[model samples]
Target: MEFSASKRIIHGFAPAFALLLLGSLAAAQSPKKSDYLENIALCNGPGHTSLAARIGGCTAFIDSGQGTKTALAIAYNNRGNAHTINGDVDRALLDFDKSIKLDPTYAKAFNNRGGAYLRKGEYDLALQALDEAIRLKPNYGRAFVNRAGVFLKKHEYDRAARDYDEAIRLEPNLEAAWSGRCWTRAIIGSLQAALEDCNKVLQSWPNDAATYDSRGLIHLKIGEAAAAIDDFSAALRVDPKLASAFYGRGLAKLRSGDKAGGDADISAAKAIQSGVDDDFVRYGVRADN
Candidate 1:
């Protein structure tokens, strides 16, 4: 199973006006300057900032007409990120497009646009935007990850693996890259390598349900039914609704000769996701196996 790539948004690129303008100098600035700085702060606040506040702050900064083209582009991109997080992909795409128009060289905006397209299931467009992002910034690990997601969706697993490899090289600590490569390698029959990748991610992020699910599949393929069951159960402990885990565990139980328990799990998985069995079939497992 291909997990969604981690989409990273670039925050505002506003200069450190707050650091430069302090005390009496900041107090001496016009009210508009103060407002502009405040808006920038709110717009580019940490991830905990409310989506509505971030969007409003970016909108305010965009409407004030006090920002340079680059600043406006950053504001639009930030607002777009807020929109994307708010589940307003159409609005996010509009903002990303506007940002790209304002500054065609803004690789982050292009990368964000690709993410929006990915959300909409427009793989070709997502690939196009991500390609531009990578072209603009060759070492953009997140862009490579997003492009790999496009390849995964397209079932171009070899390309996806290559992109994941590049992303891991560029950002060794990126959990998504490691997990993604794990899944890709598992599917490609690089069982030992995939197991190592999954273990590495679990060491850093023990609660990652997807990694557990991937490792469970790896164990299942390696004929370790008990280990597969353990990993699948671990995944379910983290994400109870993960149909893939239910399905994989069912297969493991079946292989272990617990026919009744296996059938129960398979039925439960199908209840959660009707096509989950088909996914396992595609993974080279069959119910009769």
Candidate 2:
């Protein structure tokens, strides 16, 4: 379960939150043409699976061109991030190791390497990497959030909650931190607290389909069928491509005696992706499609 939580944190880093941060940064820095070239070079991944190869290729280009050490570091770091996203923990760690070797004080490289360790279930290694990141940059809210997620996985609920509290105090607008708090609360059986954290996340990101899905799960836990259905429906409305919303809503519908609707939702979920868990089909609720 702890490992699962860590996986969730690494695989789903709240894209909306990252996008929002990027938007804010865009206004402050009009990067040069060289920056654009560097970005393209860093984006040289092939099919997203062999990120290590892509990193090597990008670094080769950086070496050939009189690209600065910063550009090479960025390439290594971005490749490591891609490898981490692709679940190649060892390769991700290697790339991050290279990035840090090039720029020893690179906080992001340490933080990302920590995430790779977290995914590999190397809790102590993850902590060490995150500790280095924090030492390098004291205001790194992301490291705090990741560390808190590690604690949550360990079921050290008090410590997890404290870390989450500190992270939120440091960065009030980090949606992932709020979502992490929600997941932690849910695990600890504090459904109300979990729901509250979900609500806060949704307030900042109303179109976030996952938030609605999570809130629906909380409602289902609390036996609020109608509320759960509403959340599931909202999630589907936001992102029609999501199979989980249909499955969740189907379960709610099944609970409410809407067999036809429930069946349709289940079918829709299966149509989108045939691999949805049978448990999801059996237990999920929704209105007739």
Candidate 3:
């Protein structure tokens, strides 16, 4: 199984805001001013899932020439996020860059930029941006979680666990933190703890294939091959494309003396990802059955 890092940004790159000049009396006095205020309101509203509207609103507001540097930065960042939601990371990065230029200490912008870098698999750059985010806002639990993901990719399991701990302390309901910590615990031989963590996460996300795969590994670690096989089967039911689940179930099948099933599963897993056998062998699992 694989522990996922933050696949997407949680919030916007700028803080929420509102303009206070909109009233019926003022709207009656000047149509131009009313349009400006209306546009600004639309720009400042949450830009999620309405990319075209957000872009148009933010553009109109930015053209209105009525906002401070910080306000303009927020507008630009909002538009950038709309671009990000629309699958345009290049535009998102440009807006994030502009947002940071306007307000260098904007921790949200840095964090968003880090997430963009992480999506690109540039781990070192992601860490640098995330470190800056934490430095600017020490209580940013999201940034801590992102950094911990980088640590996990680096195979620094202890550091990943520590960051996950800090993230969980800062935000108790952070599911990603629990999932990452569970994976780290499993790799470190803390099987029972990992099982508990996986179970807790599964309560909220019962159909999560990755968590099921993780729990299966925990069961296998504890010599409960039947239980592990069941968990792995559940994982595959949820996500038939999950190569790790197939590999894991193969191991459990072999442990339970189902030789033909084990061989078929291992072959299927290797078909999905070449060299998965060598990787599992390197992971020290009993893949030589």
Return the lDDT, model 1, position 255.
96
Query: Please, what are the lDDT tens digits per residue for candidate 1 over residues 1-289?
Result: 4354333222223345234323344434767676777788777755577999889988987887666777788888889988987889999999999999989999989998998888889989999999999999999998888888888778788998999999999988888888888988888889999999999999999998989999999999989999999999999999888888998999999999999999888898999888888777777677887
> Candidate 3 residues 260-285, lDDT tens each?
99989988998997776665554456
Clashes of each: 0, 12, 0
Model 3, residue 141: distance off in Å is 0.6
Q: Single out the weakest 10-residue window by summed lDDT for candidate 2.
A: 12-21
Residues 1-289, candidate 2: write the lDDT tens digits.
1124333454212121112222223422545445544434444453443655555555554454434556556566777777777667798788788888988988888888888888887888888988898899888888888888677556577777777778798888887778777756755668898899999988888886777887887787677889989999998888787787787788788888888998898789889877665434233322332
Which candidate do you rate higher for lDDT, 1 or 3?
Answer: 1
lDDT of 2 at 91: 80
> Deviation in angstroms for 282 in model 3?
5.2
Computed on alpha carbons, the lDDT of every model, listed in order, comes to 0.83, 0.69, 0.77
TM-score of 3: 0.81
- TM-score of every model versus the real structure: 0.89, 0.65, 0.81
Winning candidate number (lDDT) = 1
Candidate 1: segments with Cα more than 4 A from true spot: 5-28
TM-score of model 2 (CA atoms):
0.65
